[model samples]
Target chain A: MTVNIISISQITSYLRELLENDVMLSDIWVLGEVSNLKRASSGHYYFTLKDDAAALDVAMWRTYTSRLTHNLQNGDAVLAHGRVSIYEPSGRLQFYVDMLQPAGVGLLHARFEELKQRLAAEGLFDESRKRPLPPLPHRIGIATSAQAAALRDILTVLARRYPLVEVVLSPCLVQGERAPDSISAALYRLYAQDVDLIILARGGGSIEDLWCFNEEIVARTVFASPVPVITGVGHETDTTIVDYVADVRAATPSAAAEQAVPDMAVLAEAVTVLRQQLDEAMSAQLWMHQNALHSATATLQRQNPALWLARSRQQVDDLVQRATRQVRYLTERRQLQLDGLRQQLITLSPYATLHRGYAVVQRTSDGGVVTAPAQVQRGERLRLTLRAGELAAVAAPPAPIEEQHTDD
Target chain B: MTETSTETYETLYTRLQETVAQLEVGNLPLAEALALYEQGVQLAAACQRLLDSAELRVQQLQSDQPDDQ
Candidate 1:
């Protein structure tokens, strides 16, 4: 018996379908460490899932990618569930991932937590300490390289949404060896220029590419900035130290720009609303004045000259009602304030301390109280604070009272 | 709106400075402090409105940009 030869494509295609259709392999689960995890612009994730023995190529399309909870990173131990299929074109078998979870706590997770705890104890992320970014900043200074896409994106957004924001680009290295120093100096320079706000931004990249933001120098720089600082370090999936120290953190460069300034459209809408409210209030006031004037005229027409004179006096008295009300209202308010001040003064007065029966022992050196027993030495001169008035005295040691008690 | 509730930026800064000054040397009278605090609250609200407006505006400004901001 003889077998006919097939083309290369035919064999691979047959093998592809055979492996793809294998019931057990069709829907499978894989446990491996992720390597070379790259998220492309299209939202597809391409990576290698490897164990000690072998590695399998894997691709996660955007649709299924959203379902995955854990962020994928190189060397992350993960469990992937997907359909095992062969790429017919490349004749290479790859996994189409549908789910992924971290295997216990990964190294990155541990490091992230450790850094978080250290920074938290150092009060870096304190909300009370977080300065609010200025709105309608006259000039927004950016600390990023002139050539970066982040700068372009920021400039483009500012020009489009808020032309009023005078942007000052403090161009500096966002990454690489000199990035940390450059970033810190750039911040100082912007601060010196009295920029209303500062933005530290960079496009997403590898851990090393974003290492500049993760540096101690960068974190300290962000922490000490007098001008509110915003950090746009990397993609949403990535977190860095600078992000923690920043007054506000943006997942991306453009977000940093958004976080740094106020929207013009919203401001316009607010102004419009205020204007409408003012108009309504003014109209209501006008209506009230018109009704008052009409009432007064009717009263005048109803009376003869002498009668009208009396009536006019009555109207004038009536007008005083408003003035009287205003005076009473102001007086009541002032009385309330004055009463409060008096009460406060009573509480703070030295006489109040006398009422509390707390006496101050003053030293002869000065009129100040001798608070500590050690402050006075035997045979030394001292003064006393009495409920009535200040009294001069000589410092004396306790007369053997403790010794007498001990003897008894 | 009441002027008390709509303090400007300078007034807010003045209130902050006053609070710091009051906090520094000695205690303020409780009643006087209550009034000051109420005024401080108005100042705080005004300041917060500014901050919130700034944040919201930034969000709006960058909402359509080519980055994840």
Candidate 2:
């Protein structure tokens, strides 16, 4: 074989290609103690990851560094994930880290804890910061994936519980690296729409799958929301940073929806109860007024002039009847008395003596009656009233009667 | 019966409650009480109508562009 001369640039390029082409080197995790860590002004991080037997140079660009939950320090054991490559300028092997976390613990868990502590210290998770939800929200904004099962569950619950509310869906990706920004954007859209309340929800997932909700951007977005937010992420066990910052936390998407709106059934029952109360109150009022009217009518009748006139007329009629009765009784008594007087007069009359055969005599000419024989006149005419018949006699007859009596 | 459509359910319900309360106070004139009763009945009917005819409306918000921040 002929010996070929290669320049330094050519050799470095060859080494870079060889290292980058390796499957294991392209994607890997390295557990080592950190040393010689420095953050440059460009916001990039330069560090050396070393083990007991070997050491490797590592580089984290600004994009990845800005996402770090905790800063790396010298002698800190860390697990870093990236691709291994050769730096052609210096002909050195380097690892480009996209993710870094404390060793021995789960990567996402470490980041989650770190973010939780920092945000908690900033008072973002304080109870005082939580807002009260509207008792009757007219419009509700939902931030979730359009195709997510969480969306379906939430809609189902909302429809069943409160069909009067208007639902505005601001769809976004619920998972992967760009999900945090997507969720933030969705929240912004809902805010501009002036929704009464917001529900941020996602279906059950693993920690890695639900990691976007735990991102700093998503957490900040939730904390900064103008209206109260209800968060339901993953299963009941999954607690994301957004959950801690939300006004209300629910176990599932359905629960979130349940918290966001009032139940129409309960409200309808309340309305019915109010209506019943209104009916009862109105009836009572009417009854009272009717009673008043009845009493007033009675009072009016009592004071009426027509009734007074009727009573006076009755009294006058009674008095007139008594006077007429008295007059008739007195007249009858007087008539009876007069009749008795007349009967007495008749009994005492001389006409009865005449009827009993005694007679009164008068002279034919002088008309003087002779009580005895000494006073007899010859011819006097006289009228007599008798019970039956009357007889006339002269004075001579009277003298003769006395002489006859003497002879007997 | 004379209620405007602009009134919300909450407003109508609240008015109904207030009317009932006033009627329950029991000191108003007959004409005033009758008027209140009429208003209360109308409010109740309106509330019931809303509950009966209400349907949920759902809408989607389309973002102007994909968020890359």
Candidate 3:
């Protein structure tokens, strides 16, 4: 065999090509414990992934490094996914890692738990810190990916339930490395908008795909949002840190929309009920006043002075007629009695003897019945009484009366 | 019947509720009660109009770009 002399560059170049071309090694995952992790000022990440039997050097460029959900540290068992390649100048083989995650327990999950605990301890996830959602929100702000199916679902649900709500969408990246910042910034934008409530929603996805809402920045932003925040991340089973911090949590993006708006049919039913109540109240009030007015009318009739005066006038007229009849009867009886007594007196009077042509002499000094001669005076003037008139005569009656009395 | 856009559905609903309460207390004069009833009816009609006239409106903020569907 002829020995071919090759320069070191040629050898390194050949090795680089050999490792770069292998389909399996080009994209592979290595499970190991991390060690000697370093971040350069250039934003590149250098780390070692090792197992008991072997070790691998890993280098992730700044662009991919910034996308890491969890920080890499020594002794963290991880699965690094990337291509295996050689640095020709250093003559060392390394893994150019694009993604790194904890193997036994996901690094992202561990970070999520750690953050959840920290925020919980800080009272960011306290139930008391949660705000009550508006019962009927007129304006709603949505922080989500504009192109996401979740957005479409939310819009559809809102339109179906209550279309009065005006939606302000603050679109952001809902996945990948830049998602956390993008979501946080979107929340800030929505916060400034004049909206009654906010819905931070995303469709169902794997934990890694939905990791942005699990970030501390997103959690804090949701907590500090001026308008109440309703979160619907991933699925019902996938609860995020922001969900704990948000004012309300829904099972799905459509559910978040339901929470943010009131149902029109239900509201209409309520209004109808209220209208009935108002009608009843108005009628009741009117009925009460009508009863009062009726009683007042009855009382006025009972106490009417005009009617009482007419009754009193009738009573006075009856009394006057009765008294006048009694007085007239009494006067007639007295006049009849007086006339009979006067006739009796005329029948018994001595004037009847004078009217029968019997003359009597009487003393003028005293008028006395000459029944007894002893009662007559010798020259006394006497008067004979008659019913019509009285006559005066001188009396020789003493001699005559004496003769008559002697005979009796 | 007035411009529905000027007032929010929430405000109109709240006012209607208050008017209902006032009517429910049942002590107002007939004229006042009638006036309140008229107002309540108007509010309910306005609310219905608002609900009937509303359309789902979606607006996108320009600061952040959304990803491809």
Q: In order, what DockQ does each candidate have?
A: 0.03, 0.37, 0.43
lDDT of 3 by residue, A348-379 (tens): 88777677877654455654466666776555
Q: What is the lDDT of residue B51 in candidate 1?
A: 38
Report how far residue A222 has shifted in candidate 3, in Å: 1.1
Q: Interface-residue RMSD per candidate?
A: 14.0, 2.6, 1.9
Q: After superposition, how far is residue A106 of candidate 2 from its true place, in Å?
A: 2.4
Task: List the candidate 1 regions with Cα displacement exceeding 4 Å.
Answer: A1-117, A306-408, B1-69
**lDDT values, one for every candidate:** 0.72, 0.87, 0.84
* lDDT (Cα, tens digit) per residue for candidate 2, span A155-207: 99988888777889998999888799899999999999868999999999877
True contacts kept of each: 0.00, 0.74, 0.68
Judging by lDDT, tell me the better candidate of 1 and 3.
3
Top model by TM-score, which number?
3
Query: What is the C-alpha lDDT profile of model 1 across A1-408, one tens digit per residue?
Result: 899989979988888888877888876667899998889888999999999999999999998887776667799888777788878788788888876777653334444556677887999888888788876666677887767799888887776566655566677777778788888877777777657788899999987788788777778888888888888887988889888898888899898887776666676554444334434443444555567779999987786698879988999999899899999999999999999999999999887888777777777876666777787778777776677777777877766778979989
lDDT of 2 by residue, B1-69 (tens): 112257777788889989999999996798999999899999989988887887778888886555421
Tens-digit per-residue lDDT, B1-69, candidate 1 = 012244444455456546434433334444554454455455545554653453211211211112212
- Show where candidate 2 strays beyond 4 Å: A1-105, A301-408, B1-6, B66-69
